[model samples]
Target: MLNLDVVWTSEFAANKWIMPLPADAIPTDKMIPATVNAATYRDTLVGAPYYTDGALFYFRSDLLKAAGIAARPKTWDEMKTACKAILALPAAAGMSCYAGQFDKNEALTVNFSEAVASAGGTVVDAEGKPTVNTPEAKKGLNLLVDGFKQGFFPSDAITYLEEQGRRAFQDGKLVFLRNWPFLHASLSATDGSSKVAGKFGITSIPGTDGPGVSTLGGRNLAISPFTANKATALEFIKFFTSEEQAKKRLALSSRAPAYASLYADPAVVAKRPFFPTLLTSLNNAQPRPKVVQYGATTKAIQEEAYAAITGKKDTDTALNDMQAKLTELSAK
Candidate 1:
């Protein structure tokens, strides 16, 4: 039997040395939903969640206070004000996600998906119909695209990956950042790697007065169907994913756990300053479409966001095209 389910998770760093554990470590919650288009590995009661991640707002407290802002922005309009405030202050860049650069690209997809849903738009209809061109989707795309074009964020941001953004913000090149939980450790560590240590704050992703939404952006644990020692796997999972471990992940590693029980632990929450904000966003997150076509549709939506912003296409017309593409893609 494998001694432990996950000796090292992809969360800390890419699990290259420990990439493929003998078993799986995924979640079984119906709400978590599967990502692949047609089928998913069984929603097995896989290994315990070491840590999960979601959308988080990264900002520099020094810069914000200097600009006379005392609190995080709560709504989309306020987000605009905050972005503009930071941009107007020389050397403080603001950014959300890369526009339509790559698909399955966690940062871009989650950022765009969350913003769309936060604006009260559903990616798929009740009948599993595609709805990427709905009014809410249009507004969501415009929100980021406008920021991109007008330079609310760094001009080079669209070409950046999550780590690239992390480096930029840590280097003081950016004042506002929207990224995953990993930034927590990278920025706060006493280690000299980050230039902006102990100076940043986190908040829930801003909303638009409609409803706050952020996409699910982390991995869950699952046992492999081929495992010969399921019980051992489960045992290892429990040990590695206990409350104590979870807290360590929050403090030392910056990973979130999916278990509701662990969330109530004071130590766990305390270590992760953004725990409350993440929970709020998690509570409101809309699961991605379950159809086999979901991934392809997401790519289409990315194109729509870019077209509406950089392609010089009419916003309404772009949306219309998106709606059509979604309809065709999601069709049986």
Candidate 2:
């Protein structure tokens, strides 16, 4: 048995290193559809969906209330308007508008994919074809590029990874931050380490029109092809992914559960106040490109996306180059 990253499903399946899962025996019916999709490769179910995660929009709620903003922004335009109001306040004097991971690393690929998806575009289509050359894709990439050019994102954000962004938000240096669900516990801590302990709020990341899509992330449980005790492995997998176990895990460790019902459970919500918003983001999440060559695919995205975000290349030129690179990668 192996605990595999969701992005590795296609790679492992293509290499014949993992056996296809017996869908009838697994409790996939109760799992999040996006997680089930992540465990699938070329129409074959290859892994059992495990705990899952998605990006969330983290903001300084107190700042929004002070600005008289009645609700969280659901669209990019609304976010910009809110930023204008919040930044003008004396309390928000040193804060920047927003920030996401933009360094030339794997984080960049995740951020880039979410941007395209939120604008109603895809980095790669369902059939494994590159689709980053469309008008929607351009609009998506422009959100980051234009954000930097307009000073919405801090100038130093080009060097930020997850930790940097989290630190900035926890320190009350940002009005909004795009990050994963795990940050909820840390940011909500009452320790003196968090400057905005009770002042922050979470929602679905804003989109061009409405709520944005997040990049799906999590691990999957798979049976190794060489394992002799296949029956035993399957039994363990069933036990591990069962609803009872999932609920226990969530309660014990705050790990996001794959079971959809847990997100709505009163007890679960009482323990994790962010579950409802997280469920909304997870339902709209898109898996990062599921290809056999995921490593090279993500590298290509990071390079082009970094260039565009840092003003080294215009959005069109960067995405055009990315399209060609992805086209070649898919063909391989």
Best by TM-score: 2
lDDT of 1: 0.59
TM-score to true structure, per model: 0.73, 0.98
- Tens digit per residue, CA lDDT, model 1, 1-332: 22222212221112222223333343324222212111121222223444455677777777678678887677767766766676576545443322222222434656676777877777677565778767888787677777667656556766767877778877767766777776787788687888778777877777688336766645534445457776676567656755556556655655566555555668776766677777766665555554445557667766765566564676778778878987897675
Candidate 1 similarity to native, TM-score:
0.73
lDDT by residue (tens digit), candidate 2, 1-332: 99998889998999999999886978888989999999999888899987999999999999999999999999888999999999999999888999999999989998999889989999999878999999999999999999999999999999999999999999889999999888988898897889999998999999999999999999999999898999999999999989999988875786798999999999999988899999988898889999889999999999999999988999999999999999999998
lDDT of 2: 0.92
Q: When superposed on Cα atoms, how far off is each prediction in RMSD?
A: 7.1, 1.0
- In candidate 2 the C-alpha lDDT for residue 59 amounts to 91
The CA lDDT at 257 in model 1 is 66
